[model samples]
Target: MAEWLNILLRSIGLFILVLLFARLMGKRQTSRMTFFDLITVIVIGVLTAAISLNLVNVLANGLIALAVWVFAPIGMYYLSIKSKMIRDIVQGRETVLVNHGKVLEDKLMEVRYTPEDLLSQLRKKNVFNFADVEFAIMEPSGEVSVLLKKDKQPITAKTLGVSVGHESVPQTVILDGVMMDEPLTAMGLNRQWLHTELEKIGVAPENVFIAQVDSAGQLYVDLFNDAIITPKPKTKDLLYVTLKKCQADCELYALGTKKKNAKKIYQESALELTEILDELEPLLKK
Candidate 1:
């Protein structure tokens, strides 16, 4: 009974100590952690476990071991921040795998990354064709950043010389059929306005699973049963949808046009569609 009591007290004390040390170490996530950061975490964990299990003078020895393991990494982290050279030495620099459509074979060998591994990473970034890539960099955190060739990149409104409005982050107004008063207040909205907006879509506040108001004052609602996901119409989305329909129709009309008069009609429709597309492009960019 006495031995069990000692174990219980020691476990509680060590748990609190470890928690405090974790908080002191800052908020660096496991995914973004460097090699040294990972090693420090593993060593601290092992030390804490070993100390907790040992019976002879466990409290004093465990505290000393835990402090040393935790503080050393904290000190090194500070030193790395103070010096760029130290930071590079501690966390290795990013490696360029591909440059201007040419693969850096020497750098790949240095990083010990196989051609298959590079191809796999490229595929994850949606670049299946090697020729489409302008730059491919392997970050120190083992994630790859890809840049596609200029000609292969998607066209934007700026390319068509169209003006686009600013976009704001969507704010949650309701969650799980409950109105979020704070978020609604932050968005400069009241319950009366929310009820009115919900009424417009034929959805009651209690029926909503989740609702968000976008920067354009468009309300998007998801029902509890998920039977409906209706979003308030925005001018930009309407124009883009119309533009796509026009393009599809133009293609069909071009294929069916057999007479000279029909061909002239198709050409006129195509020109009008192009003008509509130019106006719609800016909205799609946003």
Candidate 2:
């Protein structure tokens, strides 16, 4: 009975100590384990087990072993932040495996990485074709970072020479059929405005599962019942299209009209409309 009681007491005490040690180690160890981290984890596990099972005759010795494994890595990690040379020696340098869609066979062989292993890592990153890869490098954590060729990359506003507006993260104003006033207040909205929006869409506040208000003053609502469809907003995109068409119509009128008064009126309208569109372009297009 005394032997069983001792074992139980030891297990509880060691379990608590392990939790405290893990907290002190920080989250980097689990996020991306380096070569040294693996060794430290293994040694700590053995020491924890020895302490719990009373396999180590001296309790102090087992604890000392645990302390070294936990704290040494922390100290090295802090030193690594201050010194780049120390970091390179500890974590090793990243190796470039591919340059301009061509695999560097020498680098692969130096790292003992087979072609099959490279392909496996590339596939994990969703890069099926080697020809599409412009650059592929192996990180110290063994994770592969891939970059596609310039032509293979997705189109963006910068490539097309267009300016875009920046939108803030949408705030959840309604959740679980309850109106959250704090988010609505933060977004410069009120319950009356929300009620009006819900009424326009023919939806009740009770039916909503989640509702968010974006920077463009657009309300997005997800209801509990998926079968019912809600009407889409025709504010930004539709308004911009309509204004463009009106401007084009004015330009055509100015060209076709025989009367000088009508021609001047149409031309003036087109110029004024163009100025207005230029001001609103960033907000609508983005």
What tens digits encode model 2's per-residue C-alpha lDDT throughout 101-213?
A: 99999999988899999999889988888888999998888788999999988799898988778889999989999999999999999999999999989999999999989
For candidate 2, the clash count comes to 0
lDDT comparing candidate 1 with the true structure: 0.82
Per-residue lDDT tens digits for candidate 1, residues 107-207, read 89998999999999999998899899999998877788999999988798687766887777888999988998888887888889899888877889988
Model 2 / residue 222 / CA error / Å: 2.4
Models 1 onward score TM values of 0.75, 0.79
Stretch of 10 with least lDDT, candidate 2: 230-239
Clashes of each: 0, 0
User: Against the true structure, whose lDDT is highest?
Assistant: 2
